[model samples]
Target: MSLRIDVAGLRPERVSVAPSPLAELGMALHALAEPGHHPGLQGWVTAVTAGLDPHLADRMCEADFLWRTTFSDLFLPCAGIPGRTALPGATLADELDLLDKLTDEQFVDCALEFICAPGYDLPSAGVVSDPELRRRAFDLAATRGPRQVRFTRRLLDDPPRVRAWLRQFLRDCDEAFFADVWARVRPPLAADARLKTDLLRRKGLAETLTSVSSAVTLDEEAARITVDKLVVGRSATGDGGLLLVPTSLGWPHLMVLHRYGWQPVLHYPVGSPEPAAPPSVEQLALRMTALSHPVRMRICRMLARSAYTTTELAQVHGVSAPEISRHLTLLKKAGLVTTRRRGRYLLHQLDVAVVARLGSDFLEGILR
Candidate 1:
């Protein structure tokens, strides 16, 4: 549904982090199920998905028109999600059926009669006048244009089709992806929720909201939190407030949607993984060890001035080339340095951005 986004000024106490409900999980899973539908996703699908049915993937992708005009983001509830920290008891079928009913009655007018603002007015928002609804319709129609309005109207007229299509789409995904991948996804997703809760307790709301993901950031003057998404439309926040859901399938990105006719919710990948986790733990140790030695720090400083070769550095330090080589290896593993081979010499240069961000971004100061 035009990748709906609702804007709000959320107070510290009002903001919360939650694990996605089963229904919401279905939506995120749908986003990734069809790699063939979007060429860009093929590599991602191949890398992460095991034993995926090629035909099913294509079918799921086609169901959303390959995310061409409108998508199933409308099906998931933006407000009143049942679970606080784990998946809701609702089965996939239960979720699909509930959405079908909502779209049948609650969203019918907004889809057909209302065209401009195209705002999804939740029944929970209470009754609104026809004139205001019409105004919103016109606003939305103007933003999305006629083609999308027509497409959405057609779907509203036939809610069963969308429901059936989604039911099958999720079933196929469950077999190939979700059934296997969901367990691994659970802990990380919960950890992310806990991390935000802790951040809210420790750093307060403003900082936690800003650090939620790269895609979400706060506007200073208005206290408006803008979440970046594929589509562009401005939506007012509902009484239900903002919902922050940590996503497992949606890694390295963010999603903003108006819950069809509910509150605005932001689904984003979890940020700042726990240091105790497997590879991350080892990686952290490497970075700490690399930054600890004085000789390496001097080498980093020198490289920042200009790229240098091992022999040149060894000559300056009055050490053997092998020792400089060893130090450079450690720095590279720490992500503090990068190298480009120029004939016989491997030119080493400091990763200035990495080093600079170490003070804030990579938890280096926290590690200390």
Candidate 2:
């Protein structure tokens, strides 16, 4: 079913792009646990060395324990999206910190609510009232599927020991697997962030949403973003602004998840699956930013026609010498223009190759 996001009051300034090592780790584990869902990840999963260890790779990360859908929220929470962190970036510690504070009642409430929530994406799905829904859900969860979150069961049955098991299991799993997965995933995640940040700035969310692949669409009239997903449905955001987070792990799919009692997050992959390619997102961002301004665009055009000293370019515009120089410096920094000392001042010449590259293939990459 399709997920509809109400963006009626949304603005580009309200949207932000972020990275999540925790979600990436969850994805890696999910791929391992349910290779059937993500056939594309098979190659990378086979190549990962950390989870190869039999002992450390215990049943903790199995497909059942961390169910691909409903139950996975227990470990990663909020559709496996990590909670907000005061840390510099997404971290395992932050996830653990949030989990550590989960009260017994809170834990049970979350587990039951998600496990019992109607798996209905369409209006056609049968509607069940709240009282009957929870009662039926609890009854079904008692026998519907095997208990996936084993620790949580103990949490309700015998609260004391579950904490220790959970703490140790989480720490050991993070150390043995997530740490390595995050290290490998960070560069691409950073690149994706750069690409989105550039798109958000230059093109704004409408254009940026288009580049996030065809599966995501923005209806400007309705101010809604529709995402095609397996079971995802409509969700309205709260006061917290919509968060757009990119990932390297789920390279091909767009994930629309509720961030647990907070704002909703639209998590999806960056344009390129190949992260090591030249003109990385950050590089592209710098170049695009350098060329974005009206004055800078004029400078590039003027320089393209003929070489000119910073003073000469300044004279044409009749602006301050310092301002013209600033624009010229940005262009040079992006390698879009070259400078050489011609007697007294530097003569800036348009770097035809850089412009052509950015205009053609680089432009396609940005759109991708």
Candidate 3:
């Protein structure tokens, strides 16, 4: 499945790179929820969680439904439809203020659209109107886990209370840790935005979009940006335009908020991060050696497009399954490829992050 965003009529004014405090806060909460997933933020996560009020910590646990998903629509101001002009100077307080503008019904409706649904689609959007549909939404949420159900119940049962609680929770989080972190991260985020905007001007939109993530590609002929995602959908940029938000906490993951009737917001992780210890010479050699082979290079390129099993790779490459497996083993050893079991098939995909940092690692290692 893929998301195809039509940008045939998109212009420089319509494409923007901005930093979002609400988006960062949502990511921070997700880091707190699943600290193990973000090894780079381990120290910060531990410190922040330890400093959080016990009640606030407990609230975050209950609000797992809010931050756990890629679609943290609650954090997106103006349904993510407001264009570039409105987003440049947006602060956390500015975003939070917009929340007060939502009427009780509008708030409940929006929550149901995002929270109740099993997936993002037209059918899921109407889950708010029908009792039977709402029950299905609850059943789907329950299937995800208990936390999803708990969070959904709070929103469904009493939206007004949930709204106030959510606002206060964010404020408490700002007071505890996020405010300081936001201040520290904003400069780089803005710098990244400026750099990307400049790139957009020089390279044109297609090349710029392709540069964002391995999962994203632009077909200049079709004038569409295709995103390799678990969900399949299509959207046009329209007048609302596209918002390219740069995030610090949302690393190693790209998020797209392309709901129908709203501006498509693509939240991509900024390229720069807090400096860390360089890789060892041994580690660098392993990665370089893995990519040195002609067959392995081809495999890496194929895996970049989509995940493939050994047999599938063999068929595509006109090689034996064992031969493909041997190549994959070397790539895995170098941490260049990762495998996930889907039913009986072990699907292998390129580790885009590791590959992306290869040049920088080589340069830094050589200079050192």
Tens-digit per-residue lDDT, 287-350, candidate 3? 9999999999999999999999999999999999999999999999898899999999999999
Q: Give the alpha carbon lDDT tens digit for every residue of 151-245 in model 2.
A: 33444455436556655766776776668778877887778778888988998788887777565678888878877554446765534467776
What count of clashes does model 2 give? 0
* Alpha-carbon local distance difference test for all models: 0.56, 0.62, 0.75
The global Cα lDDT (0 to 1) of model 1 is: 0.56
Highest lDDT scorer: 3
Instruction: Estimate TM-scores for all models.
Output: 0.51, 0.59, 0.69
- On a 0 to 100 scale, what is the lDDT of residue 360 in model 3? 70
| Order of quality (lDDT) | 3, 2, 1
TM-score, model 3 to reference: 0.69
Which runs in model 1 stand beyond 4 Å of their true positions? 1-14, 21-44, 47-50, 53-58, 66-71, 80-94, 97-101, 105-157, 219-221, 228-232, 258-261, 271-368
Candidate 2: global Cα-lDDT? Answer: 0.62
